[model samples]
Target: MEPDFPLRKIIHVDMDAFYASVEQLDNPDLRGKPIAVGGSSQRGVVSAASYEARKFGVRSAMSSVIAKRNCPELIFVKANFERYKEISKAIRQIFYDYTDLVEPLSLDEAYLDVTINKKGNPSATLVAQEIRQRIFDELQLTASAGISINKFIAKVASDYNKPNGQKTVNPEEVIQFLEDLEIRKFYGVGKVTAEKMYKLGIFTGRDLKTKSLEFLDQKFGKSGNHYYHVVRGIHTSEVKPHRIPKSVGAERTFSENLSSEIFMLERLEHIAQELERRLKKSKIAGKTITLKIKYSDFSLQTRSKTLPYFISDKDLILETAKNLLYQNSLENSVRLLGISLANLNTERKETINGEKEVSVQLKFDF
Candidate 1:
């Protein structure tokens, strides 16, 4: 066995088809049937899909039209974020009972470092099983968990026996487990990165392990170092209790594409109002305002301007967005409009003279 690997007992718990499962739990009629949680309108997108819907290739972020076409009888349910948040809070409470080092990735997933949990239980595997069972018993929702020495492996292992199961990658097996895994299945390797890896003849963790750090750095930059470390079971990120937001934004897709700026004024105003409300809810303000434009032909464009002072008012956001809108000629008819704020107040770091220095977190460093 490799001697340097940390012996922490980390578990990644992910709720199975969370939003869809919540809908099914509340409305029994939707159980065991193909359902999507989102609108079925022309411009709507699927936020979640049940297991039955997944069988037909219906997935989150898919267009409503394509989802329905994929599953002819797919039922569309409007999303209830408030209910999801309530359940998420309850789930966090459950985690707190076991460990204080709990890190939530989203409403449906979290990482628990149970190496020294409150339960006084030594076996991480058993703790995972008990947690899964408790969730089912209390919330009537099934969750899957992955247990390993670190966050990356645990996150990937969680999906091994999904929907209602857990997988544990023991310390002795960690190296072999990662080496034998498919490159595409690595947690951070998305479709684009996987394709790039395939082009470079990196098909699996073993293949990735063969490359020199210098070679990887040249090809993939800093991410190459992360891959070089993780494939050898070397991810060192701690499970953080407070996950900060990188940006806040709101967007709306129109039922009918608008050709003229005059026709989009009202839509932009409403979007600004929504964005302002979100900023206030989070108690956040930002200096950078970005306007995202999605054309009818599916092309995307963004315009951003940074301010000297933080602002979260609807009027300011709307005015800045309008300026960005008229800053350039429309490339094509607009199908979607969005407003975002970044360089957030939350990102301020303590500096000398009682001032704050804004910093950006390196997201690619695993």
Candidate 2:
């Protein structure tokens, strides 16, 4: 652990194949069978896959066509978001028993700051273990956890032994664990970023550490700073209970491809209306409005404009989206239309000084 960064006990709890597992848990016949939680249509995408489906290379975000090609017998099940939310609420209640500092990344995953917990537990590792056990015992669902000194490390460690397991990165082993970790395994390093790192001869954290801050900045811009610090075990981000969303968006994938600009305008109006409703529900507005287009061929494009003043009205959002839709000629027939608002009113625009030396012990009783 870096001396400059504050130490805190963080645990990242991630449900194991959440959606697919839920489907299996509710239906006895679906258990141990290869199932995908999504439509098995050409236009549909797989939202999740059970462990049985994963063995055949079926995964979330994969096209249903491709997933079927991978596994001929893969069963496709429609997603039940309402039921999933019901289970998620129950799971969160279990977290509230241990700590108040719970940051939900999504319905299936969250970060918990349990440095000072209700149970008066000194070991974060044991706390995570108990949480996982409670989830299985009460909900009949499995979850994985990562216990570590910071949220970033804990998030990555949580995936180390996934699908109903947990891993803890002790303070003394943080440096070595990161050094040996593959670049692709680092949190926030997606396939494209991993490819970029590989091209720079940075296949591992040890390789990333060899580059100076200036060099990484030149290569990756603002994200380079994040990479440089995280590689050295210096992520200082706290586990905020009320996580502010960076953007609010709504998109619709049409049942059939739409070609006419007039038709798209109608869809954009509907999308903007939905966006406005979401923004209003959250009591948020944004200065930036972006229109996302997904073509019939599955190609994607986005156009954005930033306004001087925030707006959450449906008419305003529709007006901006309509303008952006007309800003450029369509490359192909559009299949999906989306509107997103960024530079939100809820964002905390404060900066944290990274150089401040905070001396806190990384190793607790664990």
Candidate 3:
């Protein structure tokens, strides 16, 4: 670890229960209540749940029925993909105003490399605070921000104070903060892996860091390298700007496992809607629609269908996705379902008769 290396300023911005929050924001009557954004139909799953609902064990991806069971008073609102996309665009515009080095992780989350910002601000913390305030004042939404010397730490810091909060991890505090963190809180450590780590007596960053590199590599394969570095607060990934999106997708994990096709289709429709909104906002279309299924065992599979022409229409995308899901037999109860648009239409902008035009062409890399 190069403890004396020059630091890079990074900020991670995430919206608070994005979909549900947006719903509440649009209807003040729903504010401060246990709310979820998604359908309440038999097959419906949550896209997002408000903090109020979270207190009742409601969470994103949980089945609507289970969410309602967890919180009997839970309010379910149909997701509005178009509206969410509009707000996402506004938020991205604000990020660009500060720095062009913006990398969006999703509609509601992004990383801004403010090492050399356009505003010439020296403190990333101040910039993060200002951005959060602007989002609240202009959009009537709450956002959480984390500032640190690198992307990994910044992302961790942001979640430290969620829902209209900001947290900063200065260079001097990075090591100590990471050392004391629970291993489960690390970015890629999911529930199953966290349990395995606990069984192995590796409960915290410090505990994991104490193991030899070879031992960790033997245990977790390629991801061991990531755990090794992140535990020591060392990460070298760069924030790529305006990188062409390789795939656009949305997914929901259910609280209770689902086995019925009707329920699964309902959840797929919601994800399809989200994918369409993203495709339109990015001004990009796709030739392939992929359906992802996660079984109750946590095993996952993806099935894809490629169309003859680029498409961004909601109905077309959903139809193709439904076909793909049917073609791939569901062998087990599903815990999560996702839809993705891939093999994007890559065409450079051109002017035809003084008007901007788009031409479709295929390019493949092996």
Candidate 4:
């Protein structure tokens, strides 16, 4: 195995139950009760669930109907993305005060490259504590931080102590820490990969390390090398601060799977409307329209088409999605439907005669 890579301090900060916590913080009655933030209908899904709700097997992305069935007393609340975005901006400002090398994974989680911070603090653990404390002091919300030599390890460590806590794995401990971790705990090992690993008798990092690179490559393809290297404390992915999203999409999972082609158009229209809202909000358009379907049996498929011009119109998106949906016969009762736009035309803000202009609205390149 390769020797441990050069030391670089990275910190991963994640807010615990951000949306549900915000609801509890804003409303007095929800403080200590199980709550879910999302639509509470036959077709609605949970965007986030509080820890209390989780005890009854409630989880984000779960059908609201099932969540209610799991916890009869679970309270449902609407998601307030606008308020969440405001708080997210405030938290990002705090991150900026430390370093410009901050990569936000979402509204609630980010990774920071703190090898050389503005505070001139040598210890990453101390820096994480100070950041967490400041977030609570200013925003009235708690965050957990994980400090380690790289982003991968830091991300995993941050989850070690959740809900307003911090954990640090120094350079010397990186190897042992990884060796003792379960295969399921690895960052990229999802349900499918874990099952594949189990079939190969690889249940832990130590088991993974025992396999030869050639064998792993045959078993898991490109990800085989990724697993081998990361187990030996060798993840080289840098903290990317200005990463742009490649595509924008939304999907809805229903309480009951849909089988009829006639009833599918209504769901497709709803998803198209959401895609339109997102496209406009992001100030971008795309030429490619893609449709994703997840079958009741847990299989998935996608079909896409590229248009002659970029579009953000709901009618056009709905028609395109409708075409993709009907292009093939219904494979199975579909549990989820998703629509997305790719090959984006994201505009940049520019100053024109002292007035900022959106490049797309002018219909010309600068």
Candidate 5:
């Protein structure tokens, strides 16, 4: 920790059981019962489950079939992405009211740098409370808030109390708060990584702080340095605003693999249309069109072509992707097809000669 390092006031806000809570809010009947938002089909994945559903071993990303087996009384509802998006925008507007320094991790979670807030509220904890209250009153949603000196500590504090709760970790309490934390509770430490740390006798933050930086780096590569600092309540990452679009893409795995070029072309066209819509929304055009294919045996291939002039035309993108696909000539049945537009531009430029000259280049890897 460097002296004179400006003390940052960071707040991490996380919506509680976002999807399921939204479902419950819309329907009075679902308020107290276990609810999950996803298809009930055998191949369906659980996108979100309520706390009630979680008690029965239900979890996000679990197979719906398995969730049903675990809790026979589980109620499954279709996912409403549009509704979630609308709510997410509303919540974001509230964040902007306080500070422009907002970084969204997802629709349900964000980190806000409120070191210099609009309200001139000296206490970060009060700011967190006010924001949480505003979210509930305005959006009818419950959010958990954590206020700390840095992003890492703030994120952990938010989870300390969930479902419309808040926790503040002041500078004096930072070290003790981290020292007692479970190794698994540390950000970026997954199950396998936690197990490895445990094997090294590092089960708590104190255990982690005891290790030398060189030793930890030797064990965990680049991320070891991060872990070394976070255990001591040190983090320097700033909350960056959402970046402008550089690429737009969509990919899907087929239920049954198809070897037919016609079927693949149809799928590619659909993905191209999706990309076109996103590009139009962002007011961006890209010069590179990329085609990605995955075979039934799990082998993958990518083909890309870069045009001299950026374009957002769906027809042009689809045609270029189709040509790239044929050029790659599949040797096996294709299980997945994806198309992407990259190397974006905000506006087009013209030469003095009044000629719309453009260059195109292709790159591929087998």
Candidate 6:
């Protein structure tokens, strides 16, 4: 194993059930109670679940029906993204106070490069504590922080403790910490990858370290290289403050699954129009249009086509989406339909109301 990497300080900050926490903070009645933020309708999906709800096996991305079955008393509250966006901006400002090298992963989490911070603190541990403390004092919110030499380890460390806590792994302790970690706990190693590793008897970081780079590359392509380096504490990814979004999309789940061809076409038209608005609002034109369909039985399929030129017009989006839909036969009733625009042309800028919008800082959900 190579241990020649430079020692850089990185911190990952993650909010504690951010959406649910905000709901609880605004309403005194919800404190210490099991609550969820999102719809409870049959077609609704849970966006965030409080720690109490988590104990009942209620999780984000789960169908509302399933969440209710898991926790009969779970209180479902609607999500307020506008409010969440305000808090996220506040939290990001706090990160910027310490370092400009902050990379936000989502509305509730970010990674900050703090090797030499604005406060001149040499200890990343102290910086992390101060950030968490400031968040609580200023926002009345609890956050967990992970401190390590890179983004991967720092992110993992942040999850080591719950609601309000911090964990720091020193350079000397990095290897040992990763070695004892489970393969499933590794970033980017989802269920499918974990199952593959399990079949190869690689259950832990130690087991993963037993394989050579060439062997891993042959088995898992580029991802095998990522796993190989991270297991040995060699993640060199920097904390980028300005990361461009690769795609923009919007989708809706229906209260009633649609089976009729005409009904599906109507839904696609709505989805395409919404997608066009999103692309225009973001000042991005995409060459690739993708249509996603989720069947009532939970099966999912997607069809995409690359256009000759970038387009963000409603008519073009609708026409392309209609063509894609007609080209493929519907296998079953669809529960949800979505349209996305990818292969974005970031170099282009648009002038709306005399102001030039150059880049899109993504903060939309549909």
- Ten residues in sequence with the least summed lDDT for candidate 4: 357-366
Question: The CA-based lDDT of model 6 is what?
Answer: 0.86
Off by over 4 Å in 1: 1-6, 348-366
Candidate 5 TM-score, true structure as reference:
0.75
TM-score, one value per model: 0.89, 0.95, 0.75, 0.84, 0.75, 0.90
Query: Can you give the lDDT of residue 291 in candidate 5?
Result: 89
List the global CA lDDT of all models: 0.88, 0.90, 0.83, 0.85, 0.83, 0.86
Q: Which 10 consecutive positions of candidate 5 have the poorest summed lDDT?
A: 357-366
Higher-scoring candidate on lDDT, 2 or 3: 2
**Which one wins on TM-score?**
2
Model 5: per-residue Cα lDDT over 167-222, one tens digit each: 98877677788888999998778999999998999999989988887898899987
Summarize candidate 1's per-residue lDDT along 95-213 as a digit string, tens digits. Answer: 99899999998999999999899999988998889888888899999999999888999999999998899998887677789879999999999999999999999999999989988
For model 4, residues 96-150, the per-residue Cα lDDT tens digits are 8999999999999999988889999888888889999999999888999999877
* Residue-by-residue lDDT tens digits, candidate 6, 1-366: 223444578999999999999999999899899898886745578999999999999999888889999998899998999999999999999999999999999999999988888999888899999999999999999999999888999988898987799898887677789889999998888999999999999999999989987889899996777777788777767787876778889888888889997998888888888888888787889999998988988788999999999999988988888888888899999888889988889743422121111121222110
Clashes of 1: 0
True-structure lDDT of candidate 4: 0.85
Question: Which ten residues in a row are the worst by lDDT in model 2?
Answer: 352-361
Better of 2 and 5 by TM-score: 2
Model 3, 1-366: lDDT tens digits are 234333688999999999888888889999999998985845566889999999999988786778888899998898899999999999999999999999898899999999889999888898999999899899998999989877888888889888789898877677788879998888779999999899889999989978766788899987776777777766767676765677888888786799998998888888888888888888989898888898977677989888999999989988988888889678899988888888888644432111111121212110
lDDT of 2 by residue, 1-366 (tens): 338656789999999999999999999899999999986756677899999999999999787888999999999998999999999999999999999999999999999999999999999999999999999999999999999999999999999898899999998788889889999999999999999999999999999989988899999998877887887778878899999999999998787789999898888888888998898999999999999999978889999999999999999999989999999999999888899999998889655436332333354566
TM-score of candidate 2 on Cα atoms, chains taken together: 0.95
List candidate 5 segments past 4 Å from native.
1-4, 243-249, 253-269, 272-276, 283-366
Candidate 6, 100: how far from true, in Å?
Answer: 1.2
Error of 2 at 292 (Å): 1.1
